[model samples]
Target: MTSTGEGPSATGSSSISANTSQISLADQFARSTEEEIQFALDEIRNENDKLEKETGILTKYLKRVDPKDIQTQIKGLEASPVQQDVVRVHKRRSRSRTGSTERLLKLTTEQKCDIAQREHDELREEINKFKHETEKILDTYRATREEAEIRLAEMKKSSYEFNRDIVLGAKNLRTGRVVAERVTRYFEDKMRSRKALIEKLRLKNSTLKVQKKKLQLQLKQKEEMGEVLHEVDFKQLRIENNQYLEKIDERNQELLKLKHSSGNTLQVLNTYKKKLNNLTMESNRLKLEISQRNELLTKIDKETELVEKEREKAESINANLRRQLQDYIVPEVLDYVQVRADLYELTKTMKTWERKVDIAQMELQKYQKQWLMMREHNRTVNPWATMEQHAAL
Candidate 1:
C-alpha cells in the first residue's frame, strides 16, 4: 500500500512539474511577442520621424532656392541678341526703359521669341512634374504611416486582452490551495473542495481552448509585405532621374557655349557700360548747366525791371522840368547890357568925332599954308628973333 501510494504521488508530482513548465513557456512566448510588437512600433515611429525630417528639409531647401532667377536667366539666354536695350533701374526708380528695336536680326526676333516661349513652356512643365513627384512621395509616406498606426492600435487593443484572457498565470493550483485553505474544515470539506477544484480546472481548460482559437485568428492577421515601395513608383522615379540627367547634360553644353563667348561678349558689355556711364554723366552736366542758365535768366529779368524803374524816374524828372519851364518867357540875359546895344552906342559916338576931325584938318591945312608963305618971306628976317623971344617968354 505504501509503494502504490508513493507511485501515484510521484506521477502526480511529475504531471504538476510538466504543467508548470508549459505555463512558463507560454508566459515567455507572450512576453517575447509583446516585446516584438513594441520593437515594431518603435521602428515605425523612427521611420516616420526620419521621413518627417526629410520632408521638412526638402521643403526648406526648395523654399531657399528660388527658381525665379533661374527662369529669368533662361529667358534672357533665349532672347534675341539684337535686342540690346533693357530697362535700367537707378536709385530705386526706373531711369531708362527699353527702346524700340530696329534692323531685322540675322536670326529674326520672331524666331528667338519662339525659342524663349518653348523654353518657358518646358520649364513650366518641369516645375509641375517636380511638384507632382513631391506630392506622390508625401502621399506614400502618409499612407504607410497611417496604416502602421492603425495596425499598431489594433495590436495594442488585442494585447490588452492578453493579461486577462490569455492562459498566462499559474493554472493547476487547486489541490494545494484547497489543502491549505480548508485546513480548519479539513475532514468536513474534503469532498466539496475536490469537486470545486475539478470545476475550476474544467473552466480553465475551456478558457484555454477559446484563447487558442483567438491566438490562431491573431496569427492569421499578421500581414506579409512583398515590397516596401511599389514597382510603379520606382519606375516613375527612374524616369525622373533620367530626365534630370538629360537636363544636366544640356546645362553642361550650354555652359561650354557660354564660356566660349564670354571673352568677347564681356569686353563688349564693359565697353557699352562705360559708354552708358559717360552718357549719363554728360546728361547730368547738361541738366546742371540748364539750371544755372535758368537762374541767370531770373537775375537778368530782375535787373531789367530795376533799369525800367530807374528810366521811368528819369523820364518823370525831365517831364517836371519841362512843365516848370513852360510858364516862363524870360530870355537868357547878356553880361554887358545887351552887348550889341553897347556896340551901337560906341559906333554913334565915333561918327560924331570923325566929323569934328575933318573940320579941324581943313583949318590946320590953311594955317600951315599961311605959315609956309610967311616963313618963305621972312626966311632971313625974324625967324631967329621970334624963336629967341619965344624962348625968353
Candidate 2:
C-alpha cells in the first residue's frame, strides 16, 4: 500500500516538472521567431561550450598518458621470440593487469573526448550553415513581401481611381448622379487644362468644317451660275452613279430569282394539295369499307345465333324421339326411317354450323388485319385522331 502511494506521488511530481519544462519551452518557442533561429543558435553555443570544456579536460588527461611507456612496450613485444599462443596470451594478460591498465584507461577516456569534440564541431558547422540558409530564405521572403505589398497598394490606388472615374462618368450625360469623391488638386488642374485644350480644338474643327462647306458652296455657285463642272467632278459623279446602277442590277436579278422560286413554291403547293385530296378520298373509301365489313360481321353473328337455336331444338327433338323408340318397339318402319333421316339432317346441319364457325373465325382474323392496316394508315395520315378512333372501336 505504501509502495503504491509513493509511486503515485513520485509520478505526479515528475509529471508536474515535465509540464513546467514543456510550458517554458512553449514560451520560448512562442516568443522567438525567424522560426526560433536565435534559440537554435543559443543551444548550439551552449553545446559548443560544453564540448570545449570536455576538450580541455581531455587535453589535461592526455598529458598524463606517457608516450615513453607505450614506445617501450612496443619495442619489447617486437624483440620477444616466437612463443606458443597460450603462453603469449597469458603474458599479455598479466602485463595488462599489472602495468598497462591505468594507461589504457587514460587513453580510452581521451579518445572518447576527442570523438565527442569532433562530432560537436561537425554539428556546429552544420548548424551555422543551416542558420545562414534560413536567414537567406527569410530575408528574401520579407523583401519580396514588402515589394508585393507596395505593388498591391499602387494597384489598389489605380483601381480606385479607375472605378471612381468610370462610375462618375461625364456630367453632360443624361444621368443626374453626382461624383462620390473629390479629385485631388493636381488631377483637377490637369483635367481643366485638358478640357480647355479639347474645347479649343473642338471650336477649331467646327470652324474648319464651316469654311470647307462655304468654299464648296461658292464653287457650286460659280459652276451653276456661269462655269461648267470640271471633268474630275463629272468623273466622280459617274463613279458614284455606276455603283448604284450595279446594285440595282443585282437587286433586279434577285427579284427574278425570287419570282421563279415563288412559282416553284406554288407548284409544290398545288402538288401537295392534289396529294392531300387523293389521301382524303382513299381515307373515305377505307372508312366505307370498314363500315360495310362491320355490317357484314353483324349479319354473320345473327345467322350464327339462329343456327345455334336450330341446333338446340333439333337436339332436344332427337333426344325425345330416341327415348320413345327405345321404350316402345316401333310398329312402323317409315317412322324409324324418318327418325334416322332426321338424325342425319341434324348431323349435316351441325357440320354446316361448324364450317360456318370456322369461316367466321377466318373472317374475324381478316377483319383484324384490315383494321390494323387502317389504324396504321390513320396513324400516318390523321395522327391526332388515331387514339380517339381506336378508343371508339
Candidate 3:
C-alpha cells in the first residue's frame, strides 16, 4: 500500500515542477517588457530637453532689439543740412541774372547762413519731436522690460511647480510600478502554487479512482462470500425464533402483572394531581401578589422620579437666585459704598485745597508789603526833583 501511494506522490511532484518552470518563464517576459518601457521614457525625455533648449534660444533672438541704436540712426539722417542749402543757393542764382558773380557768391554765403539757420530751427523742432517720441519709446521699453521680467518670474515659478508635479508624478509612477510588480509577482506565485495543488489533486483523484475500481472488485468478491454466510445465518435465526416465542409467552404474563400495578399507580397519580392543582392555585395567588407589589414599586419609582425632578428645579432656582443676588444686589451695594467713600475723600481734598489757597493769599500780601517798602527806599535814594531836572536838560 505504501509503494502504491509513493507512485502517485511521485507523479504529483512532477506536475508541480512543470508548473513552476512555466511561471519562471513568464516572470522573465514581464521584466523584459518593463525594461523596454523605461528605455522609451528616457528617449522621450532627451528629445523634450533638446526641443526646449532650441525654443529658448529662438525666443531670446526674437526679443533682442536696441532702441538707442534706432534713435542714433534717425538723428544722423536729420543732421545732414547740405542738400537744403544747395537748393536755396541755386534758386538765388537763377533769379539774379544781372547780379555779378562775386555778388552772387557773396549772396550765397548770406543765403547759406540764412538757410542753415532755418534748417537748424527745423532740426531743433525735429529734435524736440524726436525727444518726445523717444520718451514714449523709452516708456514702452520700460513697460516691456517690466512685463518680460514678470513673465520670466511667472515662467520660472510655473516651471518650478511643473517640475515639482513631475517629480511627484514620477515618484507616484515608480511607486505604482513597484506595487504592480509586487502584486503581479504575488499573483503569479499564487497561481503557480494553485496549479501545483490542482495537479497534485488531479493525481490524488486519479489514484482514488484506481483505488475505487480495486475496492469495487474486492466488494464483488465479498458479496459472493456474504451470500453463503447469509444462508447459514438464516437457518440459525429460525431455530432462535422458536426459543424466543416461548420467552415472549412468559414475558406476556409478566406484562399482565405490570398492567395491574400500573392501574393502581394511576389512582395514586390522580391523588397527586389534586394536590398539584391546589399548589398551582396558591402559586397563581402568589404571582398575583407579586404583580401587585411590582405595580406599587413602579408607582413609588415614579413618585421618587417626580420628587427628584422637583428637587433639581428647586436647586436650579436657588442657583439662579444666588447668581441674581451676586449680579445685582452685591455689586450695587459695593458701588454705593465706593461712591460714598470717593465723596468723603473729595470733600477732604476740597478742604485741603481751601487751606492751601488761604496760605497763598497770605504769602501774596507779604510780597506786596515788601514791594511797597522797596519803592519808598528807591524814591529816597533818587529824589524826584533831581530826576525831573535831568529830564528837562
Candidate 4:
C-alpha cells in the first residue's frame, strides 16, 4: 500500500515535470517566433529604406544624364562651320531640292540617338535596383523559412511530450484528472499560438505575393519600354538608310547622264572592233569567191551581189545590237537595285507577320487564362456536380 501511494506521487511529479516542460517549450517557441517576426519586419523596413535611397540616387543620376543637353552643347560647337558649308552647298544645289531632306535626316538622327541613350541609362539603373531588391527579398524569405521550421519542430516536440504524459497519467485514476486538465490547458495555449502564427504567416505571404506581382509588372513594363526604344532606333536607322539610298540614286542618275555623254567614245570603239571582225569574215568570203570565180569567172557578178546582200544584213544586226547596248544599264547595278527592293519588301512582310503572331499568341493566352479561371470557379461552386459528372464518366 505504501509503494502504491508512493507510485501515485511519483507519477504525479513526473506528469507535473512534463507539463512544465511542455509549457516552457511553448513559451520559448512563442517568444522565438515573435522575435523572428519582429526581425523580419525590421529587415523589410530596412529594405524599403534602401530602395527609397536607391530611387533617390537614381533620380539624381537621371538629372545628370540628360543626353539632349549634351547633344545641344555638341551641336553648338559643330554647327558654326557646318552651317556655313551647308549653306554654300545648298545654294549650289538649290535646284536639286535635296537640301531640306538632308537637314531633316540629320536632325532626326541626332534626336533619336539622344532619346535611345537616355532610355538605355534609365533601364540600366532600374535593372540594378530590381536586382538589389530581389536579393534582399530572397534573404528575408530564407530567414523566415528557417525560423518557421525551427518553430514547427519545437511545437512537435512539445506536443509529443504532452501526449506521452497523458498516456502515462491515465494509468493512475487519482492523478489522471489533473494531468488531463493540464494537457487540455496546454493544447488550448498551443492551438491559440499556432493560429496566431499561421495568421501572421498568411499575412506575410499575401504581402510578398503582392510585392512579387508588382515587381513582375515593373519588369514587364521595362522590357516593353526597351523594345519600344529599339524600334525607334531601328526606324531612325531606316530613315537614315533611305536618305543614303536617295543620295545614291541621285549620284547614279548623274553618272548615267555622264555616261550618255562620254559613252560615244566606247560605242565607237566597239563599232570599230565589230567592223574589223566583219572585214575578216568578208575577206574569207572574198577569198572563197575568188577561188570560185577562178573556176567560173562568168558567175562572179552574181556572187558579188549575194555577198553585198549578206554584208547589208550583218550591218543591220550590228546596228540593232548597238541600240540595245546603249539603252541597257549595267546588269550588275540593275540586279543590286532589284535585290534591295525585294529585301525591303521581305522585311516589311516579316514584321507584319511577327506582329500578327504576337497578337494572336497574346489573345490565345488571354483566352486560356479565362478558361482556367472559369474551370476553377465552376469546380469550387459546383463540386458535387463535377463529382457526379466524373462518376458518370
Clashes of each: 0, 0, 0, 0
Say which prediction, candidate 1 or candidate 2, comes out ahead on lDDT: 2
- Which residues of candidate 4, in runs, are more than 4 Å off? 1-103, 107-118, 167-393
lDDT of 3 by residue, 1-393 (tens): 000112345556656776998798678657778777678679889988965654343233224323344346546766233333333334443554532221212224454455446556766888999999999999999999999999999779767754554434334454543344544555577579779989999999999999999999888898987743576788899889988998998899899999999989999999999999999999999999999999999999999999999999999999999988888744488899999999999999999999999999999999999999987787788888658867999
Global lDDT for candidate 1? Answer: 0.66
For residues 197-256, write the lDDT of model 2, one tens digit per residue. Answer: 899999999999999999999988997897767789899999999999999999999999
Q: Which predicted model would earn the best TM-score?
A: 2
Q: Estimate the lDDT of model 4.
A: 0.72
Better of 2 and 3 by TM-score: 2
Return the clash pairs for model 2, or none: none
Instruction: Enumerate residue pairs that collide in model 1.
Output: none
Candidate closer to the true structure by lDDT (higher is better), 1 or 4: 4
- The parts of candidate 2 lying over 4 Å away from their true place are 1-238, 330-393
lDDT tens digits by residue: candidate 4, 268-368? 89999999999999999999998987778657767888899999999999999999989887669889999999999999999999999999999999999
The digit string of per-residue lDDT tens for model 1 on 1-393 reads 000112345556667787999898678667787778688679889988965654443333335434555447647786333222111101112211222211111224453454345556766888999999999999999999999999899778656643333323323365423333333344346468669989999999999999999987666565343334577979999999999999999999999899879977999999999999999999999999999999999999999999999999999998998998897677667845687788999999999999999999999999999999997787668788778877999
Best by lDDT: 4
* Candidates, ranked, lDDT: 4, 2, 3, 1
Shift of residue 96 alpha carbon in model 3, Å:
8.6
